[model samples]
Target: MNTSSDDASSTSESVSDNDSDNVPVIKKSKASTSAGLLSEHNKDNNEEESINSMHRNHPPSVTLEDMITDICFHPKLDTIGIASITGDVFMYKYNNEETNLVSTMELHLKACRDIEFSEDGQKLFSTGKDLCIAITDVETEKLVRLYEKVHEQPIYTMTIINEHVFVTGDDDGVVKLWDLRQKGSEPIFSIKEVEDYISAMITNTDAKYLACTSGDCLTTINIPERKLHLQSEDHGDELTCLGLFKMESKLLTASNKGKMYVYNWGEFGLHSDEFPNATKKAINCMIPVTENVVITGGEDGIIRAISLFPYRHLGIVGQHNFSVETLDINNDGTLIASSSHDNDINFWNVQYFESLNVTEPQKGGKRKWLEHNLPSSKIHNRSDFFAEL
Candidate 1:
């Protein structure tokens, strides 16, 4: 991925030339393996040509201001919602062509850290620095109910698998599973005192398994039995983000120390067949575009496309001025919405392809320590870091 630093304004200026057909084309960089797990794959002629074509057609960027802590897209609507460090939430309606923001809504008090829409997209749920999770009517913009004191620390992430079931993670290293029907601030099932603060949570399309990533480990929980199925030590550092592709069998994780891991579920157990590719900086967010393709954002301000099944580098897009805090892919997988600590939301077009390639690991590396320390409230609340929306 590109590591050069540029101001958000400079990036935005490049984006403003969207209609120019002369923009330089990007190429898929050759991937380098870190551990012995990853293998090289040959790209077929048609597939290789498509991958090259995609790199040439760079997507235009759209910018919105605010230190976006979390972002999510409505399952069906051409709209994306964002939560900010200022304790506010906003929804942006995309243009008719679905490329730009047409409208917006400010929804919350302290920084809003997480946001999720109901299965039907009529209701919205948000949790944040204030330690409260609120359910709101999306159409009327009115708060329907508030789950107060649901977590001791600020809630960092949330996932709504279905109408009745949802999961939340906080800085306290707790993952709480809730039943919306309960109407109270109590969780039906809770996993207390995990190894590290839970930064990301996800459930498969079948809802058979739920996965939560904390630090460098990934815990997979069987939905029906609420039992821990697998705990994989895959990342080199704290696992800061996760994405489930197609189903429970395939998943991806991004870590604070710049590593990304891909795993597949097998009858025998969870197998770590591929991984150890490093990012330029701490990876804070991931969004799966297909069963094999995912988009990742990190502290270095670059977004990358990763191919899972065969394992390869697709391309990287850089525009954000600060660390990218969150990202969400539309249900159709045609657009991606991302936010950063510099307080900007950017939109990008999607690309699809087959086979891509990478290199195996080179020997002789130094031993390294891996740990993730949660930043204090002051770090997250710094005005210099969080630009106003």
Candidate 2:
């Protein structure tokens, strides 16, 4: 793997210079007296504390009112949709000047665990603990259709396959494929793998392959073929989420055991050889920033920037007071939005993301990093960050 593009050292170099200059320096005389030793020790402790405080990530960009279970960004706009535990789904339009609530709907009686916008960005579909799936019109801000009791158990996750199709996973380890053209509540196709509750379902941009995870095992399905493509060995821990990268060449699954399994997409039916321990606590959610870098949100409430090859912790982006529940990057890959169990959502500016890591899948593949306009310098001051929020 080409891990040495723009080393993470560049990011540290940019921030470290400004930080080291701010630390208070202490001078000690060459005296061998106990008083002199005591003074040096105290000075060392103070410096350590100051350095940690300086490196610590800042607070959230906006604090929501309910515990967020899921979040999704619009494909072509500066809009974000968040589903909360209190049956609230909020759509907000955010820019540098303001974060405005575009629409608010209480579409479910219980927690709405997942919400995804259609490819056209004109409609939204959500499934939740109420065992119902609802479709809403984005422009009208009205309920378009409701599929009641679509699953026998609570629906934990959902993914939009295309403009007309989507998939939903229930707590009973069932995966159901839905079609918008159908009027009935029944799924067009369903798959039952194991008894363990289905924790997550992820797909590549093409939506050709679907990967599902449960407490004990991982499975990948070929969507068009409608057959199982791979089933990994029992991980011995509850898997919470999965991420895909490099044109879907790599697959990563995270567990409640604090371990992550990496699989090569080409070796579909084989066991994964790489297992990276990202945290000692559960990694509840993760999103790939590039082919080699991924950001994870853990039960410790910290969002970590981690590199896959020569795996290492880069640093933290932001934090929460409770377990981070979900993470999403906007379609353009310029912003990262994270939600936590503490009822808050944080937005991070990723202007220098491409410079700090490798985004190209193949060594000589057409580089897409320069497609977007990255700011000349990243915004550092938190006061300048959430001013209008």
Candidate 3:
């Protein structure tokens, strides 16, 4: 698994796709949901619009008038927050077969680069090219707080660390940690360790440290100590996104060179393993749908399922006409929604994987597997991480 070799994971099997499936859905646009999103709806209020014909030929989607930049699911609900290039935030509720617009707000003047829901799902935080961060109440659909010039450069990515703490990264490599409990707008700690803009960031399960991908390297920042932990050796390509799986024991970083760099947990200075994607194309976005399986969006517009440990290429989960810009799984891991460079957000039925008949099942149940449900909760096996200090 440490080599750049392609193994069983390079297969061409494709999981089911919703591209040509027809399922009736109810769509109700509450307010300002008309643009940028579309679903089957009733012409009359309280009416369940029945259109079995068009639904058969079309995939369920949220048609955005403007290009979508980033997307995320509510921590505890069936809702999702979609960030548009126009800086608008749209909240929509989706289930197995229906979608309803919760609310929408024009939060920023420029493009909204990222959006994240609070841990409790009561608020949504959005940052964008306008250099501002907006906090909106999900229930009331009203703006709660707004900060101007949150960063010197346009904010590009964001991640909520916990219920009260959140982090934002800018185009100039600045990473700022903010606390909602504090009355002032100043960040708890502002670190600029990378030379280029940040592409993605993922904090460990405990929110103790954040592993960020920027330029060609991976960096770890100690949240409690408020210091730079260390930076991994440059991987020779632009790192795009980050994912933590194996119960947070392994960290996976996607690169522009169509590779998945795997690292030992808490050991971010170098990669322990490398798995070249089947397509050998740039992996722009990815999410772990299960413990060992991750759905990756490629440069060629195919969504592939990839398994790790003893790595294997599961198969294609879905596809897009353009490169996928973002990918996210719902709260229950039943559905995965993908957004490409276009205005459509395609939702794939991943719920089927949840109810697999486990006659000794191994991820998607096509091969024998190992016990990936690790027993240890420790981030790593090392016992002397801070002894030198």
Candidate 4:
């Protein structure tokens, strides 16, 4: 409802400036005031009030820390890897009783933008503003290989489809596929010449399909065919982040203009037939919890749980003081962890409502409450960030 033209324009400008050294100074304008008024009016609406109440009553437990640029959870381990703007990677182990960082890897010369684990969890891959991708052996704590000049600009995201295959997206709007089987080999697949820069890349569990979302569009590639199978461009603005649902059959795309688009993969080839069903605030990151449920974080410092099946707002987690940059859901889909520019990683129990039996009718039934029992650790100190591995 707060669709002010000025606010949208400012958001678009900020996103463009992010890739360059020039920082846009945000000035208060009449459009901003109108946007605020529109937001207040929407908040007072009955339907909006109901949604707001759900968010307020069962708020997610969020721990704030300062600029966390990237976050990843191990596929087979209980450890979560967090990369910071200060060019550090901290591996934190979480268990039933305690959660503490067991290792820190300072291997980058610039802010690390993304970190990922291989399918077997034997190797860790990271990319940064330094325009290089480094592969490290998690157990030995040694750099196994480094791919320098992988991109002409900063690499923003990376995803490992299997032990031998990985993909990276960079600021130059190129998505390059790397094969670990060949030594010093070039990318087996590359999707350059795209109009906008790619912000994220994701692969399905079967590794059959790959999805890439950029500032203005979403593209899907079929790995076997080695060709782009679909490309959709309905989004009128720059897309900031994206997430794939269940089997890569669905997608959630968010733009800097504070609009979210839900699309069916089948309709992608027929781009004109597909239309965005839902819209939200400017989203920075998105992760799917189920085939129909998605959690998204925005610049407004809120994470929203949205259902795609019936297209409803399930709830919201509001606690961060700054924009959430990256987030990931566990493989089991039971927990969600988010990292913010505010410099902290917060993990939340996702089944909070179901655990309370809120889905079932209850008369004189006892309420079951879930607690955040994970040990608290902060990464606010620079010494902890720069410590040697």
Candidate 5:
């Protein structure tokens, strides 16, 4: 794996020159094996050119030397911020034609754990296993803020609350809300409500509550009061990811046991609904595609499109040879980016789902992730829409 020091600006070698062309054959350096995790998936798609393998053949993707830990798409562009195990974060501009390295930040002594683009897309916030918090100016590629000792343990998760305020959680379960307007590295409000590390965190649209999931529980903090709102009873499994859908009224947390524990946004204690994963493999990462559809990456290396309300796995979006780690969608709802320990980042065209929501139907979205792709005749991808909203 090449660190920022080794080769930060490595250009994408395999790319199609045009978007209208046939799906490009994006191949990885690693070979596939069924050593383990071969229970149900083995029977689902057995062929090399399986039906679910989207595009003309193999879908378009980038395979870097470094193992990817997390993916954060830009809020306003087609840029992607990738955190690597080598303690560096690389930003790249990608499309169907090319993937060009834009910038690279060597911010931590250990691995960069999480990264978030500010709401305005002006600054990039990152926390790492080095117990540090860094804010980098997007335009200048310079460090604007750095808290060398922001936490006692490694910071695992973080969320942007508003224009000035943001929150972070550490491996020791301490949650700290910080303000850019504040001078010191210390948080404006600090609390420790969970016994285990915070695995994921999300805030509602109103930014009134901060929902955090941990190894065994979920914690909610009232933002206006700056205090713990409620902590749920032990969920008996590690909650890996969090998402809000159904117009932000319903909440769901993915578990290590391959289940979705649903909770009402205001009422945050025990889960009101329990949904099971059809593959029965743990969901490690997720991002909402639309209000009703969420895309999840599972422990079995498959990225899936799942629907709410009826609660069913819609279809496979993409797959890796290793357990999936993170998922993100670009500023445009058309493409979905997912990463796994396999050192590959794959993109799936999801503009099909947006066609169902927008006034005019989108075109170019094909059948690769679902049982069948949406009708491509009218499928197009628009930039103004974001699923997380």
Candidate 6:
């Protein structure tokens, strides 16, 4: 494996000049294995060829300013929204080779931290460092409403709870629940438990619980009960990202310390022995490709695939020129998109992703972790596991 310092060298290689033409074969070099990841000599010749083939198959990236903070795909359309630190939101129609700007809106006065589309993809919601939340009509490209000073500090994280409700977390470690119908400056509900910045928040499949993470602890709140469920002790690392697995029965949090902690849902005090030293570098973002499989982007600028049940490294999927700031998958799971603290957002093709999501894991096969007290009823559908909504 190459060291992380060499990851950006891979991006120096030019993409194919012809957008319509097939990607030319990549000559093996330090650039081929960005960040000194897997070397061609380490895998079977055919497997190495396949990995290179996939790398060559990726679409050209969308370039933007370093101010770009977040990107989200429209639920039902071929549209993408780019939010930037400069407080501008740009909409683009993305084809395989090119991204055409559809519209641009300057709504926030400061950095736009995060953005999400409503369930129908008709309305877009965004939060900003300006302490405001803005809703835009996707079809008309008009600002529907703006909630100013919604939080005391800069809002950094957000999650769509459901059609009628959404959630936001700010730098002050405050979490607020908002109702779309209310459209008020004040939130419908608010909670302040963690003393540091809110790094990430996630709602379960049923929206029965919401999990919030900071530099050290993970806090769970019961939605219906509107009360604290559990607060885990500090993991001694900044929890940068979180994901759920095993039918949402397990919670995994990745830290800046290059470790991933796995906990049984609702039991937050200890980590399961299933995952240890999940990655060598600090992970910034993660998305589940399947119930038992996930892809993570780290401080090293390399993106890797990992298996959950037995905690094995699948392999590296791709790399970025800088640390990956965020990750998103389309509704069909055919494409995985990642954004960095730079001007580029890269797209990768997930071959057979649909088929893989639908098929059940083979029993008594190579994955011994699936055989441990695994119950038949515990199986969850692909959408439920990813919790895209």
The residue pairs that clash in candidate 3, if any, are 9-312, 9-313, 36-63, 36-64, 36-65, 37-63, 38-63
Q: Give lDDT tens digits, candidate 3, residues 94-197.
A: 75466777788889898877888887788888887888999999888889998888799988888888878899888789999998898878999999999998
Model 3: per-residue Cα lDDT at residue 182: 88
The residue-by-residue lDDT of candidate 4 on 102-195, one tens digit each, is: 8989868877778888877888899878888899999988999998877887887788888788888877788888888978847888877476
> What's the distance in Å from true for residue 347, model 5?
0.8
Each prediction's whole-model lDDT (CA): 0.62, 0.70, 0.72, 0.63, 0.73, 0.70
What are the models' TM-scores?
A: 0.72, 0.75, 0.77, 0.71, 0.78, 0.77
Candidate 2 lDDT over residue span 82-118, tens digit each = 8776777898888754678888988899888788888
Candidate 3: worst-modelled 10 consecutive residues by lDDT: 1-10
User: Which scores higher on lDDT, 4 or 6?
Assistant: 6
User: What is the TM-score of candidate 3?
Assistant: 0.77
* TM-score, predicted candidate 5 vs. hidden true structure: 0.78
Better of 1 and 5 by lDDT: 5
Give per-residue CA lDDT, model 6, range 47-76, as digits (tens).
535644444454457877434688888889
- Provide the global lDDT of candidate 2 against the true structure: 0.70
The lDDT leader among the candidates is 5
lDDT string for model 5 (150-176, tens) is 799888888888889999888788999
- Clashing residue pairs for model 4: 65-343, 66-342, 66-343, 67-343, 215-238, 215-239, 258-281, 258-282
* lDDT: worst 10-residue window of model 4: 1-10
Cα TM-score of candidate 4: 0.71
